[model samples]
Target: MNYKKRVVKNNQMTNKTKNKFTTHNKNKKYEQE
Candidate 1:
């Protein structure tokens, strides 16, 4: 479902965007590692 996409976009709208993006990036890194 697009539900997760909606929350992710909504989070990117607030100050939490940076934190969320940072966390997402970190998770991506761990996934690759």
Candidate 2:
């Protein structure tokens, strides 16, 4: 049960990072335009 909880937490962290990365890319795109 603890392992499952840890995995879920890690997934959430990765998702947050992914969101930040996508937003960063979008900002770069706007700058280029």
Mark the regions of model 2 whose C-alpha exceeds 4 Å error after superposition. Answer: none
- Alpha carbon lDDT of each predicted model: 0.88, 1.00
Highest TM-score scorer: 2
Q: How high a TM-score does candidate 2 get?
A: 0.96
- Residues 1-33 of candidate 1 have per-residue lDDT tens digits of 699999888877875878888999999999999
Residue 20 C-alpha lDDT in model 1: 88
Q: Tell me the RMSD of model 2 versus the true structure.
A: 0.3
| RMSD, one per candidate, in order | 9.4, 0.3
TM-score of every model?
0.53, 0.96
Error of 2 at 21 (Å): 0.3
